[model samples]
Target: MKTRKEKTGFRIPDLSRAAGPISSIVAIAVGLMIGFIILLISNPARALEGFAWIIGGGINSAKDLGNVLYYATPIIMTGLSVAFAFRTSLFNIGASGQFIVGALGAVLVGVKCTFLGSFQWVVGLLAAMVFGAVWALIPGLLKAYNNVNEVISCIMTNYIGMYLVNWIVKSTVYHQLTNRSLPVANEANIPKLGLDKLFPGSSINGGFIIAVLICIFAYILLNKTTFGFELKACGYNRFASRYAGISEKRSIIMAMVISGAMAGIGGGLLYLAGSGKYINVEDVLAPEGFTGISVALLGMSHPIGTLFAGLFIAYITVGGSYMQLAGFVPEIIDIITATVIYFAAFALIMRNLLQRFRLRKGGERT
Candidate 1:
């Protein structure tokens, strides 16, 4: 019989290594700890109250949670875009450019294609996806054939898309009084599916539902299909896959196109949410494009995980907004989120170490 000392390892084993949601959960918890520390530093007397406010959600209305869903809709799409490209080993940093072009397409359809009545919004969304795909295709092709760095090309396209969309809006749908694109026709609006009644004072609509379904669809496409397998194979090792007869260049282009489409769909869903979002001649990149990258990282680059990641990010954002009532600046929310991202990276490292330990222990046992 094994002695008591032999029953277990001399040192305690760290459980963080096992594959599961443990890492993500620990990352979030530690992130909150950091945020709490910040809160205490900023306002010692009101720190407890402010911290509660950050996590209390809404004290007065269901609309608070509803608004979180509203904000999450587009991010979920953008997150999926980033995650899909990441899985294919293509860093599509041009999601911003794709998102802008897609928004332009949706706006055009919203303003001119209202004649289609109830079918107008659907057509507008499809147009947006096509526009985004086309925009990303330039960088994809350049990377595939000319060996151009996609990151640089994507950055260039971001400016191009920004200026192009600005010009398009100015020349066509310019609303001079508002200094933005004109209001979309009601016919092009996404239906609320009675969510408005369920959560009053919120912009919640069917777009969130659509985003969820699309997330599932992307998961199936990436994990359960032969094409997905080939794409991943190309990503894992282009030379090996080429020897196996895979068209590496084609895979690269297709992966980017799909990524851009997802981002474009996000733009459409956001602007068509019946919330009166309009394109302005802002001198800034679409923030959602970058936010999606963070969401993808937080979700560990999995499409299904991205869905929940998007939702959680949105939830925290909403909670963060409430911090203002407790005398905190809105920017404090940004700090908290950044800290969360930082700790999440640390948690990933710990998880990797844990996995290595498990493998080594198995080897010793054998």
Candidate 2:
């Protein structure tokens, strides 16, 4: 046995050197096993088959892999959006709203404009990014100037945005308004990446390439840019950063704006890839934005990690839906995701325990 002080004195390196990877593996395994057990309780026969299908259907063909990547595109963007805000110590709970605004903006541009044939895509995407930034800036400015909590302000903005977009789509001049019924315009449609012709049934698009480039850009911005340093410093200590001549107000607003832009771009990618034209405002607020938070958390706020995290999530979502069709309830994926998040929350606690054990052994040897 060792004294309490001795047991608590282990080096940080000894505690976490191997624990990071180990914890991740453990977290994933435990989460999946728990999901399996839940499925077993719900329907054992389907459980096994569902598990098999999830693995087989998602990895059996090149096309399947393409679908996974397709789904991963938006997830990566949204994950970066959430991660960027986390670095600034801001919880942007309104990514959903910002995403909707971006979608609406993109659709409006895509439909109303007919400049260059190939250039229309760029214009629509740019419109989405700019509008999304402006939408998010409102909450950010309020937080910075009025001492409003971003979390609350963002949530309110989500509802307001939803209603406003719905009104615009249903009543504005852009409304289809045909003889009997109105439909979204054809020009506003995002063309498939020719994957439909090549693969025959895939929804993969150029958005995948854009997503990868954005991830690289985000990584560079966060790790290599002066703006990132200022944002991070403000997050760590606003007072200290201010004393150091960094403007907290500016950093906060800028951080949120960038975050909003990333999210907006994600929404544009989503719309351009599929989902046809903006059907309804309600359709815009899918759980992807909320799921982005999980991606950010699981990735530990690292850009590289976010890419993998997004892929993993996309795998489970697409694969999980297949599993549901096969027999097992799709909710199993939700259970697994929740379990993983729960375990992730305790990473610090586990590190402390491992440190204590290492210290005790070292003390005994001494």
Candidate 3:
């Protein structure tokens, strides 16, 4: 028995399947540790209490939990948008442009199409998706036909969209008194579906439910469909996929379009939540789109993972808001969020290294 055990030698555990989740967890923990250290440095006396608030503030009440879900809806949608594009090997940094364009379209419909009665919101949502897709199409066309880099085109579009939207809002939907777009008609607001009674006083609504359903749909689309296979194949090897009869150009375009549609839906959901949020005439890009990039990275570009990641970020955000009572400034919250996202960027690299190590050990064992 001793001879047999000695002969067998040691074997490495298979961790290929678990690499993504494990790397993400490690990154998140490291980020939180850094945040705690920063808190200690900023306010040594109240560090522990502030950190506690950062971790547990979301559970303070039913209202806080509800607000978490409400805040999560748009990020979840944008995260899915980025995650889907990542799967197709497309970097869609134009989500900000797509989001703002979609918002404008939705608001246009919501304000001017109250004649549709209860159906106004549905039409507004669809308009938003269409607008976003059209905005994204420019980069897709450039990338597929002219060999232009999507990143460059996306950056250009973001500024163009920002300025263009500023003009459009002021010309068509501007309210001089508020310097923001006019409020949407009541009929165009998303239905709460009894969430009002459940979460009372919170902005949570059907948009959260819709975000959940879309996450499930995205998972199924990416994991269980022939089309998804083609898109992924193109991503893995564009030339090989083209040789195998998969249309790489078409896949790229479709991926960008779908990604844009998801972002567009996020814009619509945020505005239609009846939370009194309106588009202000500013030259700034939407922060939700950039936040989506972080969510996608933290989730390792997986649909369900993106959903959970979005929720976690939103939870941390709500908790961070409570830290002010413990003597931490609002800027401290931004620092912590930036730190977490910065660490999240390392997750993919860690996963790849883990897989490489596993493969090397497996070869040795064989």
Native-vs-model 3 lDDT? 0.87
**Total residue pair clashes for candidate 2:** 0
How many residue pairs clash in each candidate at the backbone level? 0, 0, 0
Candidate 3 lDDT tens digits, 1-366: 223334688444545358767877777787778889989999899999999998899888888889999999999989999999998888988898888888988999999998999999999989988988888899988888888998999999989988998899999989999899999999889899999788888899999999999999988998999999988888777898999999999988888888998999899999888999899998899999998998897787899999988998898889888998998886776676677677767765776688688789879999
- The local lDDT score (0 to 100) that residue 366 gets in candidate 1 is 97
Top model by lDDT, which number?
3
User: How high is each candidate's TM-score?
Assistant: 0.92, 0.87, 0.91
Query: Which stretch of 10 consecutive residues in model 2 shows the poorest summed lDDT?
Result: 177-186
Candidate 1 or 2, higher TM-score? 1
Model 1 worst lDDT run, 10 consecutive residues = 1-10
Candidate 3: worst-modelled 10 consecutive residues by lDDT: 1-10
Off by over 4 Å in 2: 1-11, 14-21, 173-200, 274-277, 281-284, 353-366
Model 2 per-residue lDDT tens digits across residues 1-366: 123435688424454445655566578788888887887788877778877765566775677777888888877888888888987899988887888777777766666676646677787788889978988999899988998999999888887877777777666524354311123244545566576665456678778778888888888898899988999888877898999999999999999999999888887887766544343534345567788899887776777778888888888877887886867777778889889877876777777777788878988999
Whichever of 1 and 3 has more TM-score, that candidate is 1
On the 0 to 100 scale, the lDDT of residue 326 in model 1 is 86
lDDT of 1: 0.86
- Against the unseen true structure, what C-alpha lDDT does each candidate score? 0.86, 0.77, 0.87
Q: Which scores higher on lDDT, 2 or 3?
A: 3
